[model samples]
Target: MNQLNRTTANIQTIRPIKVIQFGTGNFLRGFTDWIIDMLNEKTGFNADIQMVQVHGKRPATEVEKQEGLFHVITRGYQQGKIIDETRLITCVRGAVNPYLDYEGFLALGENPDLEWILSNTTEAGIYVDESDIDPSQPPASFPGKLTALLYRRYCKGGELLNKALHILPCELIEANGQKLKECVNAYADRWKLPDGFVAWHSRQVHYYNTLVDRIVPGYPSDEAAEIQQRLGYCDELMVVAEPFHFWAIEGPEYLKELFPTGQLGLNVLVVPDLAPYRTRKVRILNGAHTTIVPLAYLKGLRIVKEAVDDPFIGTFLQDALHSEIIPSMDMDPSGLEQFAQDVLDRFKNPFIRHQLSAIALNSVSKFRVRVLPSLIGYIRKEGKLPPCLITSLAALLVFYRGRYKGEPLPINDTEEVMAYFSDIWKSGEPYELVPRVLAMVPFWGLDLNQYPGLSNAVIREVRALLDEEKVWLV
Candidate 1:
């Protein structure tokens, strides 16, 4: 079989590069780049991407070796059908690693066609690095590198509004685009860049807070042989993802004209605000995972599909989602219900082996951010504690005890979080444990014990869960 490249793939396009993407990872390739390719084909949005590697350790060797050509293999259940599709991606022009050639990386800023910047450097990518003051060298952080690039662009086109790039950060953090902008501004102030550049960035540049959803498992290692055989080529960059894809971009409606993804019946939404959508995803999808992980794992379930398939666990998840999580959010009830159902369906996707233990990592923080808001919201709305959420909270605390069925469970988290749980869990008594955990202001941002009857409910659930009593929340 031939290597997957432009020639072997019989692909040729010389579109102008309009995007400089940070992080040439699987998610971006399968989700963002795939969307761009669709836009180019369907809407005549003839724009190419120049992928820039943020991590300084190595260049984008695989992307370069394959000549920015790859395949996105979509294989999963969607709309009561198993959809298997493959598309050869051709929107990526090439790649550059700033660590190897800073000038080449900086040269991307000079491209006249460049109008947008996309990134998914993970949640930790957008931050201020006080040490990264020198702009002459490649900065150590994602925001620092982006700031350097924007400065280069600013220098090339002084006071030109069109030159300013629309930054779309796909990081999972809340207010991601705003956070990234703050980081860039912090760098500019620390490095003492020109006042004109700062003003230009503030006035012209647009940073869109975006929420991207797609499970890109990347490289189908187990089925690679069969897949490559069917495709009749060796694609080192083949990314496996689900059929369901959605991108909620918080921007002006004019973004529809700019990106035009929605024009082709794509699941992309350019809305005035992304709060509802963000809350919907975090509280429902992520919340379901965090809620199910501990309890399901304790029930001897390993993967998400198995947990969701189990009758008892399935009902528990659905009840928690529809009864508690969705009702708490201030959105269209029908829309929220549909999204919640979609989330449950995604969890039952057989093609994806989402491990419970994997989701259990940093579960303390996950619970606080993902589920706690809804739990409190339900209480405020109904004037009573949500039974399912409280049970999950107890299961979480019990799960952190780090043992189940006489075997040590894999509990991954920061040293501080782990130590805090370790110290609180030393006492075998549920009453003592519940109060201490609830008073953790640093974790939940408030004394969760303050909620009327919350401590008692949690204590009861904790005792039940610890005693190995089958106290199903639903």
Candidate 2:
């Protein structure tokens, strides 16, 4: 089979590069690049991407080898039926490693057609690195690199008005675009860059905080050969993702006309605020995952599909979401219900083997961020402990004991958390264990024992699980 490339794939039109993407990773390719490709084909948007390597000393070898051409295999359940679709993504014209070719990377900013900057450098990428003070050299952090690029653009454009670029950061962190801009400003202040450059960055440039959702399991090594054989080509950068995708961008209404993703019937939403959507996802999708994983794993379930397919565990998850999580959030009830249903359907996607143990990693922290808010909110509003949430907490503590049914559990957490659980479980008493765990301020930020009747409620469920070896459904 021929290697997947522009020529071999018969991609003719070389669109003007309008976007500079900061990570040549699977998630960006499967999500943003895919969307851009859609715009190019469906809307005549005629924009391509120039990917920049944000981290790692090595070059973007796979991108170079494939000539910035690859396929996205979207396999999952859609509308109650299994669907497998493949599309050759040709929006990425090429990639450049800033670490290797600093001049070439900076040259990207000089492009007159470039208007948007997109990034997904993980949550930790939006930070100021004081070490990246040298404008002559490539900066150490993502924001620093962006500052360098923007400064170049500012200089190239003669510091003119209305020359600002749209920065869309897809990092999972809250206020991602604001945080990235702050990092850039910090870099400028620390480096003593031109005052005009700072002014242009602040006044002209637009930074839109974005929320992106898509499960891109990149580079399916296990099924690579079969996939390549099926496609009749060898694609080094092939990315596998689910059929569902959403990009909620917090920006002005005019951005809709600029990006025009909504015009293509995509789930991309340009809203005045991303909070409700973010909260909806966090409470419904993430909260359900965090709440169900440990309990399902304890029930001898291995993967998410199996867990959700099981009648008892599935009902538990559904009740936990609709009854407790969704009701706590201040959102449209109809929209919330639909989102919850979509989440449950995504979990039941048979093509994706989402391991419970994978989701269980650092579950303590995950529970605090993902599940605890809704759990607390529901209690505050209803003036009673949510039975399913309390049971999940109880199951979490039991799971931390590190063994179930005489088999070792895939327990992964901070050493301090593991040690705390190990020391607490030494007593073999649920009544004593529940209060101590609830009072651990470092884990929960506040002593959860102070919540009215929360400790007692959790203790009851803990004792039931300890005695019965299963979640006692109330």
Candidate 3:
């Protein structure tokens, strides 16, 4: 398959598109669709992909041109070995545009075989909208569109309310599908889509809150031309991903029988609770990521791979996770340490050169969510700031400077966080600036100015990290 260079290969067996995917991005094709193919291959429970673009006019038209054929290149450490694997993904039969093809969207419900609804429209995809009620051409919001399709299905199928589809949303938000269902129900009540119809949907559709983890670096434009030459075919939707993957769906135990990822060795799980899993990622993995970005990038590194590869920076990241983030977390420290180690290893994956600037996106919020709690928790527990974490905080503040050595640096973040910190930068000296920034009660959730030692510690470290380019013992 690698030598052939043919990006698209016809699946010898055609399974009806039983799963309606709300996203057609590289992440879905590489992560979820890849898992579905493996399930089909091993357990003979074949599922086909019917992708619905999340938004815009170009998406539906753009995806359809490819005839739903795409590639998934997994580049990372797999089972203790460095692996670079590519597959011609075949699960998607076609992508439908709800904007232009609403009847086509609703008509899928008429298919008795339809059982699953999967989505990874990113966190931004789910929104509450009060407009667009034409059953013939669904609305813009995912919940509204889904409700419209479902309502039309209810009318067509004599309201077989018990015929619920297992909907698993893979967005990163809390209670993803539950929130989505709430949005849909809001629309149902607002538009008066009917009492019985709402009952059927409420009863039948099993909306599972899911947690998915994977790093899908989609459409390698910089490497596309050379990659295409290597592959021999030009694929418009070719996506590259990490060897790691996870999908923890929160629902009844019986739901596992329907998804069946264990038999296939895929990391996808139907768990009773995702809190522990969420914390593991939030505190450990995401925590480490946020902690390292500024410290490593400001030290003249470009990507995560480099950040982890450099001895001083890498050791700082490892120490921060173990000494600070893990201890602060409620999960088993040993378990978190292992997970953090794996995350660091993944960061060093030579095949996938993950850009640090990409991770630097919205870093203020990233630090606030991923690193701040750990900082506060560890401070209360140990009575002082953690070692390398302080380094990251200092580095993060220094990073928002928008310049280093007179060269303009790219610092991507939400306007509010950026603007908030930007005001601090102009407040003057590096010493006073630290406290001024930390005083954002909403940012830190408390008066950081009150923490006398902690404020001074941050100021001292920020000046040191900027000077030495390393946070450890100088």
Candidate 4:
């Protein structure tokens, strides 16, 4: 089979490089680059990407070998139909690692056509490094590198306002774009870049806080040979992702013209504020995953699909979503419910073998962020505790017992958290355990015992779960 490249794949044309992308990872390739390719084809947004490796000394050899051509294989269920499709992506012009070729990477900033900066250096990628004070060498941090690039661009273009770049960070952190801007400013201050250049950056640079959603389980090694055989091309850079993709950018409405993925039947949204959308995702999709893991795993389900397929677990998840999660949110219930249903459908996707144990990692923090908000919201709104969520909390407490059915359960958390649970569970009594856990103000942000009847309800549920009575099911 021919190696997947521009020539072997019969890809003739390449667009002008308009985007300098950081992090040549699967999530960015599968989600953002895929959208850009579609936009180029459908909306005549003729632009390509200059991929950059942010970490380590190694450049993306696959991208280099393939001449920036790869395939994104999207497989999953959406709207009750199974979707399995592949597209050859040709938007990436090439990749350069700053550590390997600092001059080449910095030279990207001088491109006259380059208007946008895109990145997904994970949540930790955006941070201030006070020691990154030299522009002569490649800085260690992502924002430091970006500040250097921006300085180069500023100097190259004589600090022209029009030369300022549109930065859209796809990092998972909240206010990622804003945080990146802060880091850049910190670097500028530390490096003592000219006042004029700093002013130009402050006035002209566009930073957009964006929320990206897609499950890009990269490099499907187990099925790579079969996939390559089907395509008749060996693609080392192939990325596997779910069909569902959404990008919510908190920016001006006019910025839509730059993207325009909405017109291409894509789920990209450019709005004045994306808090509602973020809340919706956190409360419903993430909430569902966090709520299901402990309980479903206790029920002997190892993977997400199996848990969602089981009648009892599936019903429990559904009831928790429609009855508790959605109602807890302030959005239009109809839209919320639709999104909740779609989330459930996504969970049932067979292509993604989402392990419950993986999701179980740091579940205490996950529960605090994902599920606790809805639980509190339900109490505040309806003046009562949500049954399913309350039961799930009990299940988490039970799951933290470190063993189930005389076997060690896959409980992954910090040593401190593990120790806390271990020491607390020594009582072997729900009555004693429930109150101590409930009063864990440091964990849950407040004493959960303050909520009337919360401790007692959890005690009952914990007792039920421990006894294997199935009374909660009844």
Candidate 5:
């Protein structure tokens, strides 16, 4: 079989490098790169990407070897149909590891056609690294590297108004673009960069907070040989993803024209504010995951699809989403319902075996972010505790006990969190544990016991869970 290279793959056309991507991960390839390739094929966008390695010391050898050619196989259920389609994505011109050749990485900023910067360097990637004070060398952080690159562009353009770049960071953190911009400004301040450069950056560069959703399970190692045989080529960088995708960008109206993925009938929305969308995702999609995991895992379910397919767990998830989570959201009811449906469909995807243990990692923090908002919101609106959410909370506490039905539960979290749960479970009293856990301010950031009837409701559910040995779906 031929290696999946430009020459072997018969990909002769090369587009201009208009996009500089920060991460060469599965998500970017399966989501952003796929979208760009569609735009190029469908809308005459005529653009390619230059990928930069952010964290790794080594280069993307597969990408470099293949000349940035790979296949994206989108497999899932959509609209009552099984969607399994593959596309050859050739939009990535090449990759550059900044750690290896900092000058070559910086040289990308000097490209006149470079108009956009996209990144998915994980949540922790967007931070202020105080050690990266020296601008002469490659900075230690993502923001620092971006600052150096932008400074080079600012210098090269010499006050040219068209030189400003549009930055869209797809990190899962809230207000990602604003946070990244803040980090870059902090870097400038720390390094004592010129006021003019800062002014140019503020005026010229556009940072848009974005929400991206897609399940890109990269490198199907088990199916690699079979997939290669089917395609009659060897592609080491092949990425597997679901058919559903969404990118909500909070930016000016001009962004619709600038990057017209929406025109391709893709779920790319340019909105004035991303707050409602973010809240919708948190309360519905993520809330469902966090709520279902503990109960389902306790019931001997291992994967997300298995949990969602089981009658009991599936009903619990649906009830929680429609009855508790969606009602708590402030968005349009119809829109919320549709989003919930989409989330359920994604969860039911058979191609992705999302591990319950993987989702259970850092579950304390996950609950605080994904489930607590809905719980608080429901209480605020209806003046009563949401039954499903409270029940899920009970399940979560029991799950933290680290043993379920004589089997060791896969509980992954901080040492402090683990020790706290371990110490509490030693008492072996649900009645006493419920209120005490609620009152711990370090865990919840506020005393959840302060909410009227909240602690009592949790205690009631916890008692039921301990005594009944099954989730009492409200």
Candidate 6:
């Protein structure tokens, strides 16, 4: 028997219905679609997931050629031991490029079978400018495109309010579903769509604020050959992620009855609020990443696995997250600690080699969003600056020094910050720069001088690191 072509060997043989998914990239295939496949297997949900490309740049021809078949390789801790599981996820019935197939994309709304519209268009996908959204193209922004589709659906269904989709926005921002809903309303007004249609949309559609967590490191291109050989089969859409995953939805309990995500043992939930979960994860896991990355990488660790595997670096990071990071969070401490532990475990997963460089993307914005808040929170809560996060801030300044472990770091920062650091560091009085940098009110929103001893603390640690110059990183 030919193993690859065997029908029973595949997992996505479910009856094709309709699920218009935005962003058909590896993250979705490996993360959301993987869970959908499992739900199908366990709950007998006849689901059809049709993905549409969010951007026009990525060529969809090759991806379409793969015939919607993919493999998800899950590896990490299971019952205190390492386990790797390979599951063929075959639920993607078809894929459409909204940028290329504008007609087809709009027509998806007309399909009465289309039940849900799921999206993971990243942090920037929700905001849609009606003017920029080429009427020809499915609109530039995710919300604009979605709004256009919803309008069409309303018209096509003739006020069939029942066909409105349950929107699950898997974006990174807080209140993503709510934001999307707001944008849809904005589009209706901007495009001058009929009032009945807008009112009908208001009545028909439902959007839930969601929080999805999974270490979808995405495609394992470098290890694809090895993975394929180990599995004794080939998969074009193979995704490697840690075993730990979470999906939190903010909505009524009846939503679960419709989606049935929990039937498959998924961590999916329908809660009154996802805010607490979001706060906990963002502060601990995301805060740890931003805080640890610059420090660890500057100390010479390349990948997250190494950063966590090495005794000193790993222990340092773990301490920082648990002691400093978790304590700073306003959420329940015990629950936050548990979540942090799971996050650490996910970081240590052998399956995903999460690169430090990749994590370092948009470091300036990252520090502002993920780390700075923790530092401020720690000070507010404990009446003193947290050591680890403060140290991480010092590390960030050092990392921005435009050099890294005998290699050019290619440091990217705003011209203002770069010039400020450059002008200050050149002042011959080098050690004073640390205090000056800390005292720089414009850099941080609040004055560091008000922090009692924060400047001295940062200056002392940064100077100590520079003076000793020993690589404490993994």
Against the unseen true structure, what C-alpha lDDT does each candidate score? 0.89, 0.89, 0.79, 0.90, 0.91, 0.77
CA error at residue 415 for candidate 4, angstroms: 2.2
lDDT of 1 by residue, 57-98 (tens): 777888998899999999887767777899999999889999
Per-residue accuracy of model 4 over 1-474 as CA lDDT, tens digit each? 999888888888978999999989999999999999999989978999999999889768888999999899999988889999999888998999999999999988888888899999988889976667678998999999998888888888743457657899999999998899999988988888899889989988899999999999999999999999999999999999999888999999888887788789898999999799899998899899999999998888999999999999999999999999888877899989888878987898989999999999999999999999999999999999999999999999999999876668888899999999999999899998899888988899999999999999999998888777344334
Could you estimate the TM-score for every candidate?
A: 0.93, 0.95, 0.90, 0.97, 0.95, 0.89
Ten residues in a row with the worst lDDT in model 1? 465-474
The segments of candidate 1 whose C-alpha lies over 4 angstroms from its true place after superposition are 158-164, 423-426, 469-474
lDDT of 6 by residue, 1-474 (tens): 123423535543556656789987767887888888887778857787888888865557645666677688887864467978888777887688777778888888888777788999889888867465445556888888888788778877653567667889999888999999999888888788899888888887889998988877777888878887776766566788778888899999888888898777777778998878887777788888888888888777888878988887788888888777777777778877777778778777776678888877667667877888888888898887788887898888777766644566646667887777667666624368767766665666656667788877888777766654545423
How far in Å is the alpha carbon of 108 misplaced in model 1?
1.5
Residue 387 lDDT, candidate 2, scale 0-100: 91
Model 2, range 174-262, lDDT digits (tens) per residue?
99999999888888898898998888888888999999999998888999999999999999899998988999999998999899997
Worst 10 residues of 2 by lDDT: 465-474
How should the candidates be ordered by lDDT, best one leading?
5, 4, 2, 1, 3, 6
How much is 200 displaced in model 2, in angstroms?
1.3
Question: Candidate 5 — number of clashing residue pairs?
Answer: 0
- Top TM-score: which candidate number? 4
Q: Count the backbone clashes (under 3 Å) in each candidate.
A: 0, 0, 2, 0, 0, 1
TM-score of 4: 0.97
Give candidate 4 regions above 4 Å deviation: 158-161, 469-474
Candidate 3 wrongly placed segments (more than 4 Å):
1-10, 58-66, 78-80, 133-136, 158-160, 222-234, 413-423, 426-430, 466-474
Q: Relative to the unseen true structure, what is the C-alpha lDDT of residue 361 in candidate 2, on a scale of 0 to 100?
A: 96
Question: Could you give candidate 5's per-residue lDDT for residues 176-251 as a string of tens digits?
Answer: 9999999999988888888988898899899999999999999999999999999989999999999989999999
lDDT of 3 by residue, 40-152 (tens): 87886788888887677664654666667677888887547897888877777788877676677778777677889998877977877646555445677888878887777
Among residues 3 or more apart in sequence or in different chains, the pairs in candidate 2 whose N, CA or C atoms overlap within 3 Å are none
Find the 10 residues in a row with the least total lDDT in model 6. Answer: 1-10
Error of 6 at 302 (Å): 2.3
